[model samples]
Target: MKFLYILGLIVLLSFVIIYYQFNPEVYSFFPECPFHKYLHLDCPGCGSQRAIHALLHLNLQKAMGYNLLLVFSLPILALQLFCKIYSYFTKKTLLLHFWYSPNTPKIIFVIVMIFWIARNLPYPPFNYLAA
Candidate 1:
């Protein structure tokens, strides 16, 4: 488990470095969102790559423009990551406790679904969500 965790960390760091160094918009090697390609609409994570790039460069406006959802959720994700690391070190853990509270999954699901749908809407504020 420790080895796997280290491997995962390395892979994640590699991706972060890559995102930091390359502009996803101008790079052909970066993976495109298949959901947008197939459905012709922005999904919840459509601009996450570009957002990461912008974030790595400390461009908050551009990052939020790319993916507001991702920017807004980073703190929660960081907290969950911290909880996981804490649990892993202690060896007494609830695997999903930090991010889940029975109703949490349902609530998150609803929110993401709503964002996914709203981002596709062609109206004023909704269209702003498109990446």
Candidate 2:
């Protein structure tokens, strides 16, 4: 099971690396954010595709420029993913499951909402936040 899980993860990562290496920004097939299209506002996910593309190419600054929130969140998300996969394979928890705390979700939601609103604000520093 562990071997299968690792194999699956490797394959998935390989595909993602290859796809993003091609640069989703230039790819017409990559779907544009519906929220931005309809509302003319930058959603929380506006530049995620370009961010991922820049990340895959090892351009950290470019990735952050595309989506600063996503760049900052990747490490936390990766740690959570590592903890989950580690527990699954070893049948023992690794990281303390702080994500299960009731306040965590609320805090995360508030942060996301703030980021969403801040990015959409049409002002100097706030405008720079938009993709």
Candidate 3:
């Protein structure tokens, strides 16, 4: 399991590095969101691919235009990675935990719903959340 995990990580990292090195536009691969084309609504992850592409290229403004959620996500991911490395070297463990009292699936559903609604809202700040 550990070997497979490490191999998978290597493969994923290689792809990410290559993709950023190339900087191909996501629209070239997926011209339009199938869900958006058919349903007329943006999914929770609508602009994630484009956002990542922009972020990897160090295009912060373009990345934010692609997905505001990424602004928070990238920092959180960096912080988590920093903590994980710090803990590993300090003989401390970082275990996963949830602050909510609700059941896991329910909490996930709620989060998705909130994201969906927030992105679709027509108000100024919230409207910017949409792709």
List, residue by residue over 39-80, the lDDT tens digit for candidate 2.
999999899988888888899999988888999999999898
Off-target runs (Cα >4 Å) in candidate 3 are: 22-27, 30-32, 77-92, 99-108
lDDT (10s digit) by residue, model 3, range 1-131: 55775687699798787657654452265456788779877777778777877888888888887777766567857776666666766869774355234586697578778988888888988888788
Which stretch of 10 consecutive residues in model 1 shows the poorest summed lDDT?
92-101
Q: In terms of lDDT, which candidate is stronger, 1 or 3?
A: 1
- Report the lDDT of model 3 for residue 122: 87
Clashing pairs in model 3, backbone N/Cα/C closer than 3 A: none
Per-residue CA lDDT of model 1 for 1-131, tens digit only, reads 89998998999899999999999899899888888899899999999999999999999999999899999999788777877888899987746563658888899889999999999999999999988
lDDT of each: 0.89, 0.87, 0.73
* Top TM-score model: 1
Any runs in candidate 2 off by more than 4 Å, and if so which? 1-11
Ranking by lDDT: 1, 2, 3
User: For model 1, which pairs clash?
Assistant: none
In model 1, the runs with Cα more than 4 Å from the true position are 90-98
Q: What's the true lDDT of residue 8 in model 2?
A: 86
